[model samples]
Structures are given as C-alpha cells and as structure tokens.
Target: RVGLVEWEAERHLLMLDIHHIVTDGMSMSIFVEELLRLYNGETLEPLRIQYKEFAAWQQSEPVKERLKRQEAYWLDVLEGELPTLELPTDFVRPAARSFEGDVLPFSIDKQMTDSLQRIADENGATLYMVLLAAYSILLSKYSGQEDFIVGMPVSGRTHADLEPLIGMFVNTLAIRHYPSGEKAFLAYLNEVKETMLGAYDHQDYPFEELVKKLQAPRDQSRNPVFDVMFALETKEDNVQSFGDIKIESYPETHTVSQFDLTLVISLLDEGMNGQFEYATKLFTRNLIDNFAQDLLVIITQICEQPSVLLKDISLNGQSEQEQDVLEAIDIIF
Candidate 1:
C-alpha cells in the first residue's frame, strides 16, 4: 500500500507500506532503489528469477535434502531442556501476548564505537559478535539465567540471484548462548563468534519449520524458543533523489513489538545508534529507558577491559548493595 499526504504546498509525505510476508529489510532497499531509478526515467534490467521461481526451487528435492541436514544441526544445538528467561516485569503479563510497544532510543559515541571495533578486530570477530556478546551478558544479569536463546535474523539471500529480487528471503535464528560471569569477556566473545559462525552455516533452515519440528508446548503469552531478539542493521542509503524532488523517509508514530523485547542497532557513518522496541504490557518506559543506559555501560566497561569478569560489570553505576536496596524497595525501574 502506498499513500502520499500533502503537508504543505511544496512538501509531502510518501508512505510505502508492504507486508512482511512479501518483503524484508533488504528487499525494501532493493524496492526503493528500483523505484527511484524508474521515477528518474532510468530502465532496470529484468529480474533473473521471479519470486514464484524461487519458491518453487525451495521445494525441490535438492533443497529438501539440504534442509534435512540443516535440521539435524539445529536439533542438536537446541537439544535437551530449553531455558525460558524470567525477566522481572513492571506489570502482570497479559493472558494473551500483546503487540503494543514503544521505542527507547540510544546512541554510542564514535570513540566507544571505535574501541568496540578494535576489540572485534583483535578477537577476529565482527562488530555484531561484540555487541551480541555484550547483549547476552545484560540479558543474563537481568533474567538471572546463564543460558538462554536470543533470536537473530539472517538475510537468507544465500544465492546471488536472490539478492536483486524483492521477496521474503529473511530467516530467524534461535541463537542460544551461555554467558558465565566467571569467564573473561574476551573468552566469552570468542565463544559467541564460534557459535554464531555455526548458526550462520545452517541459517537457510526456515524458523517456522524448526518450531513445528521442535513441537514445544504453545504459550499464548510469549513467542516460542526466544522472547527477545537482537539485530544489527548495516547502513544503506536506499533513496537519494527522484529527479531533484529530494526523497527521504518519514517516521511513523505507530509502533509494534513482535517479541517481548527487541534491540536493533544501526551502523551509521557517525557512530552506532540503537533502539529497544519493547512490549509495553510487560515493561514500563522508565525500566526500558534504564535498560538503554545500562546497555551502554556494559559495552563501555567490557570494551575498556576485555579481561574483566562478566560479574564485575555494573548497570546504571549501581553497586550490588545499592541494587539490592532498590530491589527491596521495589523501585529499581
């Protein structure tokens, strides 16, 4: 669906709303790129493969065999009892899950960003690995669960042909990690990098298929496998100008949360910015605001001292005694 609202004589708002079933984050960029080319009277080459052809290929025997092998890997990794995160909520969880949510925005300065990148480089890991390691530690501290799963999205455009096509070639990976406080930060990060590499190898397996195969008991109030998700968005300038019309994106007021909590980080030229999109039914705004601040604290501490034990890290600059007092007073948020 597309709409254009005129805000002034020379200004307008263009809204392009597409369902997630047909397009993803990567596809949106492709769509906008082609849209601009056509708007500027530039011709685009015909797609090598249409969406239907790609769907058909997925159902082919060879793809089926490949998925079977990948399924074995997922099952082995997620074998035995699954851990459910028990994060303390501000309100009682609803009988049914709610999509109502809000975003808490935050940013990391270029200095810290560069430091993080250095750590990633020293450890032979990507920035995503470094951030994910820090995020896992925060979740462990909050939920008091050393082992749990966090959903990560993978761009499932494995083949070059699929890249130019605007379709839903995105897959969710249930990445489980055990963040032990006793372990050194660098050691844990390397472990996370290894686990992520393995998950990426089997990322082609559909998440829906994994859920069906796992046959876990359904919970109406939460998502299966993982309650929280994390994603790092690589920067892309999708639409620049439509023949000097000065095209740009317009922000929307309505927000939705597909999970209990989702942390999205975007790598920009200036630095790294992030937002925590969380379900309002399960968290207060103040609580999530503190989460954003505390996350930055965790990242700063770990980046400065990679050898620091995870347990030594502090949130919101609170000592253990102070944290306990706040918990006792029931005013931590």
Candidate 2:
C-alpha cells in the first residue's frame, strides 16, 4: 500500500506501507534504489528471475532435498524438550497472546561502542555476536533459563540474482543457546560466533517449515519455539533526494509487538542506539527501563573485562527487591 499526501504545492509526502509477506528489509533497499532511478528517468535491466519463478523453484524437488538435509541439522540441534523462558511479567499472561506493546529507546556512547567493537575484534567475532552473547546473559538473568532459543532474521538471498529483486527473502533462524553464568563472557561469545556461522550456512531453511518439523506442543499463549527476537540493522541510509525533491525517513510509531520481547539495535554514525519493544500486557515501562539499564551494564562490564564470569556482572544499581525478583526465577549457581 502506497500513498502520497500533498501538504501544499511543491510540498508532498510520499508514503509506502509494505507488507512483510511480499518484501523484506533488503528488498526495501532495492526498491528505493530502483524507485529513485526510475524517478530520474533511468531504465533498469530486466531481472533474470522473477519472484514467481523463484517461488516455483523453491518448491522444486532439488530444493526440497536440500531443505531435508538442513532439516536434519535443525532436528539434531533442537532435539529433546525445548526450554520455555520464565521471564517475570508485570501482568498475568492472557489465555492467548496479545500484540499490544510499546518501545523504550536507549543509546550507547561512542566510547562504549568502540570498546565493544574492540572486544569483538579481539575475540574473532563480529559486534552482533558480542551483543547476542550479552543479550543471552540478560535473558538468563531475568528468566534464569540457561537453555533457550533466540530468533533472528537472515537475508535469504544466497544467490547474486536475488540481490537486485524485491521480494520477501527474509528467513528466521531459531538460535539455541545455553548461557552459563559460570562461563567467561569471551568464551560464551566464541561459542555464539560458531552457532551464528552454522546458522548462516543453513539460512535458506524456512522457519515455519522447521516449526512444522519440530511439532512441539502447540501453545495458544506463545510462539512455537521462541518468544524473544533480536535484530541488528547496520544500514544507515535515511535521507535522500530526487531532483530537488528532498526525502526523509520518518520514525515509526509501532503499536504491535510480534513477540514477547524484541531487541532491535541500529548502528548509526553517532553511536549504538536501540529499543526494546515489549508486549505491554507482560511488562511495564519501568521493567523495560531496567532491562535497558541491565543490558548496558552487562555490555560495559564485558567490554572492560572480557574474561569476567557472567554471574558476577552488574545490573545498573537495581534495588534489592528487583534483584530478588530476578534471582527468584531459579538459582543455577
């Protein structure tokens, strides 16, 4: 759905409301580039493979065999009872889940960001891996669940031909982790890096298909495997112009939450900025604020002492009551 609102003569707002079913984050970039080129009266070369052909190919026997091989990998890693996170919520969970949610924004200073990047570089990992390890620690602190899955989206454009097209090529990977507070942050980060690389290798497998294969007990109150998600956006393109027409991206006012909690971090020129989008029925602003603070504290501490044990990490001066609340989940160590 696209719209154009003309505020005044020579002043108009172009709006594009795309659904995830037909397009994805990477596709949006391609869409915008093509849109601008076409606006400037330039013709793009014809795409070799259209979306219809791609869809058909995905359903072909060869693709099915490949997915079957990937399926075995997922099944082996995810075998046995899956861990359900017991994160403390302000309100009782409803019989069924609700999408009502809100976002709490936060930022990490440039110095802290640089320190984290240095730690990542030293550990043979990317910044995303470092952040994922820290996030897993945070989840462990709150839920006291050592084994859980975190869902992340990967661009499914494995072929170069798919790069120039606009389509929904985003696939979610359920990254399972067993975070031990007794383990050093650096060690856990290395393990996370390995897991991330393996997931990337099998990124083409569809998440829904994996869910069907698992056939875990169906729960109306939550998602099949994971209720939490993590995403990192490094692309910073926001402002553009087309022949004297200035275009600017507007900040979104999100009213829906796809999961119980989602941490979205954006890498910007200024620093590392992000937001925690949480379901309102399960959390209050104060709790999410504490989460943000605790996450930052963990990141800062790990950057300072990469070998520090996760159990000894700080929680941004949380109150004794708050500490008790988190500790009450389950004392593993």
Candidate 3:
C-alpha cells in the first residue's frame, strides 16, 4: 500500500493520501467524481477499456511506425551539450539524488493574469505560451544560460477511448527553449509559442519512447536531459461537490524534488495560482519563496512592456550579459 488516509474525522479532518504511483493530476479528478456519483447511486456507462488494454496496444506494431516520425524531431530538439539547469544548491549533491520535496504556493493577481492573457491573445498564443515564456525567462536569469530544457506533462489521451477511463493517461515532455536574438520578453514569448505548437503537433510520441530514442546522457545525480518540470493545469481541477459537502483539492508537496523541481500553475477565477515544488536537499522555503515572487514580478513587468530587454527584468540590476551589451553599444556610439 503506497498511501492511506485516516478517515476518522474526529482525529483527522477530511483528508486524502494517495501514492503518486497510482494516479496523476487528471486521473485523481476522475476518481473523485466517479466515487461521488457512485455513492449517489447513479448508474454509469460501462468503461470501454481499462489501463491494461491501453498499455498492451501501445506496444503494437502500427503505433511504433507512427512514433518513428517523431524520433527525428525529438533528437534534433535535444541535440548538443544539454546541460542541467544551473541552480546553485545549498550543499553538494550525493552520488544518488534523494526525492524529498516541498511546495510553496503563491498567486498572481487578476490584473497581471489578465494582462498576460491579453498578450497571449494578441500574439495568437495561448496563456500557456505566455506563462511558459515568463517561466523560461526566470530560468534564463537564474541559470544565465540562453538555452535550457524544462519538462511539461501532457495528457497522453491521444486516443478517444482513453479519455473517460481513469488511468495514468499522462506523459512528461521536455521543452528545450533557445532564447534568440535581442532576447526581448515578447520575442521570447513567440519562440515559446512556436515550441508549444510543435510539441502539440508531435504530442502522440510517448514520452518514454522519445526519451529512449534520444538516449540522453545519464546523470544519476539528476534526471536525464531535463531536471525541471513546468505544468499549466486548467478548470478540470476545480473543486467538486455533491450538494453541500464541498471538497476542494490542493497540490500535496513534500520533502522530495522530482527532477530538481516541478512548477505547477493552475488557472483560477481570481488569477493564476502557482505551486513551486523544490527539492529539500538543494533549497529552502525562503529561497523558493523569493524565486516565486521574482517570477510574479517578471510576469507583471513583461505584460506591461513586452518589448523590454530580458536583462532589464533582472531583480539585482542588469545582468552580466546586459552590461556586456551596454559596453559594446557605448563603444560603437
């Protein structure tokens, strides 16, 4: 048994404990709704197929051929000396990394969220693109590297049958973003949008299949290829109720960091809610909180003036690159 919840309300107010192994974000929602409906004595349609069938079919011949087309694209995207995010850890990492994690929650005000949405719409991009750009900007600033990779989870329900059934119908994809040219936040948004579009177009390739194909250099101290994950969750995760007993779900973060860190951002009526999951082995709450605040600042400023140089977004004044660029400009002038 991976997890259990003490249902004795006297001892423990309404709570849930589930192992990450059995369910993902999407699957948990399905499980809850189904349980409620079943308790209310409502008959439901029979499941077309279960997880076992889906797993078996994934290994079939035709699917393998289809996935081949994606191999070349993933390989090219991940090419070069793929380095991990250069986040400074508090201590030297052990030979084998631990999975302890912590979750820091924060919210972006409605005005900033709306501004970002407008920017996204104006640019023919989704809010995901806008948020991702801002996130990439933060990573860029922290690591001081124009190019790096971040993982994003995709609902692997490419087939219609897999949608209604509750299972691990999700896959994690690595997005390797390369900041181009003058590195204005606006242009970076466009770059991220394009990458997102490509990822969607090629979403059918199973993540494991892609990772196996890439053969990324392994580092036991961290995850292969990418060490950070970013997810943008939507309305599907809203609070559910069966007439008065409202049950709201919040992300559960712990002492382990899965792949250096995982950032989960959810869209809410008030604004965007962000949960930063970091490894306890490498960071503290204060540091993660500061990073989260900085991200909000970045998002706020970028939407207000998208054309601003990436260097200008720096919290500690101009970055080294910004100074170098200024020096060149001064010499030329």
In candidate 3, where is summed lDDT lowest over 10 consecutive residues?
4-13
Clashing pairs in 3: 99-256, 100-255, 100-256, 100-257, 101-254, 101-255, 101-256
Write candidate 1's Cα lDDT for 123-229 as tens digits.
Answer: 89999999999999889888878999999999999999999999899999999999887888999999999999999999999999999888888889989989999
Kindly give the stretch of ten consecutive residues in candidate 2 with the minimal lDDT sum.
Answer: 314-323
lDDT value for model 1: 0.89
RMSD of each: 3.0, 3.3, 3.9
- List runs of model 3 lying over 4 Å from the truth: 1-22, 235-239, 244-253, 316-333
Residue 287: error of model 3 in Å? 1.8
Decide which is better by TM-score, 1 or 3: 1
Question: Residues 1-333, candidate 2, lDDT per residue (tens digit)?
Answer: 889998999877779988889989888878877888898898999999899889999999999999889998898889999889889999999889899999999998889889989999987899999999999999988887789999998888899888888999899999999888788888899999999999898888899999999999989899889999999998456777778666777777888898999999999887789899999989999999999999998888887889987777767755335677778876855
lDDT of 3 by residue, 1-333 (tens): 234356665332345667766567778777778877887888888998988898888788987776777776777788766767888667677688788888998988898989989998888999888888888888877777888899998988887888787777677778988764367877878888889888887777877777677777777888877888899888554566686455666454366678777888988888878989988888888888878988887887787788987777755455557767888999999
- The Cα error of candidate 1 at residue 253, in Å, is 1.0
Give the Cα-based TM-score of candidate 1 against the true structure: 0.93
- lDDT on C-alpha atoms for all candidate structures: 0.89, 0.88, 0.79
Question: Worst ten-residue run, lDDT, model 1?
Answer: 234-243
Which runs in model 2 stand beyond 4 Å of their true positions?
Answer: 317-333
In the predicted model 2, the residue pairs found to clash are none
Off by over 4 Å in 1: 7-10, 237-239, 318-333
